[model samples]
Target: EHKGAIAEAGGVKALVDLIFKWSVGGDGVLERAAGALANLAADDKCSMEVAVVGGVHALVMLARNCKCEGVQEQAARALANLAAHGDSNNNNAAVGQEAGALEALVQLTRSPHEGVRQEAAGALWNLSFDDRNREAIASAGGVEALVALAHSCSNASPGLQERAAGALWGLSVSEANSIAIGREGGVAPLIALSRSDAEDVHETAAGALWNLAFNPGNALRIVEEGGVPALVHLCSSSISKMARFMAALALAYMFDGRMDEFALIGTSSESTSKSASLDGARRMALKHIEAFVLTFSDPQAFSAAAASSTPAALTQVTESARIQEAGHLRCSGAEIGRFIAMLRNSSSILKACAAFALLQFTIPGGRHALHHATLLHTAGAPRVLRAAAAAATAPLEAKIFARIVLRNLEHHQTEPAI
Candidate 1:
């Protein structure tokens, strides 16, 4: 009846009384009270009542107590609910004066129980959503704690890893947290997690990588911390399609500005040689386009391939062609080169990929290569047509690919001097 009455009244007074009991009474009663408070706090009415009855201080106390896992989780959840209201127009001043609230929440991130830790991480994420709270989290080693959790929990439950990684990801997106991630030895663990056998782990790792990639300095750290190799391996992993896509998308992002860095891998003699020694090994990095094209045999696979490639790299070549003359082409050229190399099993899909990759090249020299390749196709160049017709099994798509190839060449064709 008491529980039902609390629920009926939206549980405000009961939650407040329970939180008071937890704070002042302490022990079995506190645990029961904390749980009741957590349940009641789920309703704004009850949460408001608890807030009025010193619930914030009580929850903070539970969070700081090392022996109370159940209490800490309940406290974290209650605090999360309260902080979520910090954005309310009327409660701004009240929340601002909730001294030690942020500190207590940060402490819960270190809770022995994963549930409390994840909830704490989530609450911290919500709190840091505010610029003011972001500064506070940064000052209180929140980023460091989140990153540490991410690293330590890499092999734990995928859910816990994800929550920790997601928190780190959110933190890393901020410049302050990005630096903290680097300083706290977080990049290596994220890179390692990116290579995990679990799809969820890989996705969380990818998100973390994406957040870190937002900063050029972090991108460099990712590379120096051995992220590149792990990402490259992920690109070719037969594990989860989503993981592969994320790997590809991330590599594409890295290559956007760090094209030279990729040159070391793409143009490596060992990669290009494709010697008998690697006969049974997975396809080399230079052959990524070929691998992508092969996957097009299945529509689902094609969709996966598209998802994996960067959107910036997916734009029509004709569109990118105009600006291809600048630094744009340099990046495009590398992508096109890889696309061409991947076009071994030619089809309209392969042609489109090749054209899109080539379109990024605007330099006269790059255009000359594209022009040459196109001409060979126009002159009924068997190899050129075959490469361009990679997706030719689909007739309409094939015809379109042929037309695009011819038109691309026609635009580049240099007429004899008058």
Candidate 2:
């Protein structure tokens, strides 16, 4: 299947030929052909076949020249499906690299038809995973378009809300785009969307908010827009563990003692009635974050990591808490260094949060775990981790995570260099 048997089976060439021959007339032939390719593009194995058979050029032609909404939706869906296989193939960047492909998809986001808009946004979302495509989409006015979509989609289907917010989430991974999204009024709709009853909607919205929260201006904007309580709700109640985890991280970054300067909490003089409400919001965020981390801890497994000499025991403990998606989270060495510094910070909550972030980054088998472990090792983290583990005042979870980190370091560093 991965060999793209469709080409051998002759199906891919047939669909591509049909798409190339059909014009954008009233007939549904072109639409059906594009739609069939779209369906095939969703299969990882068949997707390459479609591409190899010149399907991308055919689909991009339809996306560009076709006036039919049906054809447009199918073409965009096919592009989205094609871009979805980035991990296994080059389709993500390949889609964007196609002539007029990125701009065409960006145009499709403004489609009057909701289906076209959703598929276009999803294609951009998937495309945004590629570094070049992420910046390219923004250059194509994607930030403003997506923010407007978020604003207008308030009453639209949950599917629309999810994609609109998701597209923003993908773009906001970059610092510049994160700020751009906030300045373009992206944060308000995301905060609204985060309160949705739809799990997919709020989960994606929470992700956008999480990235947006990394910037101080956006963090304060979130607070000004009443995003604190919304995030607090997701952190405490979301059925999706990833949603809860991200909401907690957003709050952590907000409360990591960085935003105290604003009059949001109180003026420099410190009002008798503090407005920041840091006491309750910070407490709630930390409580749930700690809870989220502990959910992965098995007392029995941790006992071995904590007491035994076997590296496998520690590896078990580390993997026990592994959130595969968290490994995809990229943090600079500066961020890792800051976490090391937080290990001995005055508050145990910050220490625990720091430990949690490091644990996520250092778990064995993660995409970036080895990179993170290397950073930790170079920072002379073992001594600091030993201190955190032995600190009399450290929270139990913090100490547990610190030990896990130490063990993880011991385990990964000793591996044979490839």
Candidate 3:
């Protein structure tokens, strides 16, 4: 309430002044201040107001130099909030200023203390969302630092490795950062993590692979370098239920990425600013998906046999009576159409996954495959969408999972003409 009053009393400036004085006042004061700043930044009004007061610069420095790891964590969090808010505007100048702030953050990414470095990597990722910050991060050698962190995870504490892998995954999602990640030897480390004995390490590795899969070029490398087989093994593994579930979720995203790229291929499309890269990416993605399907279809006789030996692991997959595995397991139009039909079943999780899988077909140049193959149109999709929307408005537990469905429908709707 007092914080609300401070925010209401004089807007963002009051909070900014308080944060700066408290943060720079010394260890205890800085920690207290960082806490307060985090609270304020959580609210958009306060965040935008704080951004107005050179809050970015102060938070970045605090994140860099603060001795107390807790204070640094809070400061890093505040920076993430601020960067998230600023990057949303698409304002070049605002992003450029934030880029300058990221330079300091990159330094902290290599901090002697592991926790501080983790927090710093997360902060850099938040800032790097925008083009300006992406350039800034690349310039500051973020790619090298993140890769090194992932590599050292084997020797580092489990908690530190988890944090480090997560940060690298965040950066890997962006196109600019994807190139850097590849150049910095991140792929091998990420693939290696998929097979880590630690559950946390496995989850982090899957998350990184999901991010890298966003770029079609990386998908084949991920498969050739053994990511898909490793992840498939984990999904079918009996080691840990949670790890298997996460691996399944990550593969869902990777599969969606491949389908999305395939849909963008050769539509005789007029060249737009996005034409070159998008088209190239689509071809690469199609090749990767073809290879993945070939291997996944016959895992026992596939190229990477070690990663495919998961019959023991397959028993661990908790299958619901309501959800049936695709018997034909083909990527043909009829197969996809049947999959969409399965989504309308009463189970929210089933519906959500189906909706997402359907979204992959909406990209463009791929309409012909579905047109002849039994894919559902927008009219057929709305029923599942309405179910998801209703679920999203229900109580919290039901809401989060349902939101995923709604988001997939919305993403597909954004390019309706395609």
- Name the candidate that leads on lDDT: 2
lDDT of 2 at 51: 83
Clash totals for all candidate models: 12, 0, 2
Candidate 3 per-residue lDDT, tens place, 140-250, comes to 777888788778667766666666676676566565687668667788888877787777777767766765655555654565476666766776662554445445544
Q: Which regions of candidate 3 deviate over 4 angstroms?
A: 1-3, 10-15, 18-25, 64-71, 84-96, 155-163, 195-204, 211-228, 237-356, 360-418
Q: Which pairs of residues have clashing backbones in candidate 2? A: none
Task: Please report how far candidate 3 places residue 377 from its true position, in Å.
Answer: 12
Candidate 3, residue 237: CA error in Å?
4.6
- Candidate RMSDs in Å, in order, are 13.6, 2.9, 14.1
lDDT of 2 by residue, 164-188 (tens): 9999999998889999999999999
Clash-forming residue pairs, model 3: 236-313, 333-373
lDDT of 1 at 77: 70
What's the TM-score of every candidate structure? 0.56, 0.89, 0.54
Worst 10 residues of 3 by lDDT: 314-323
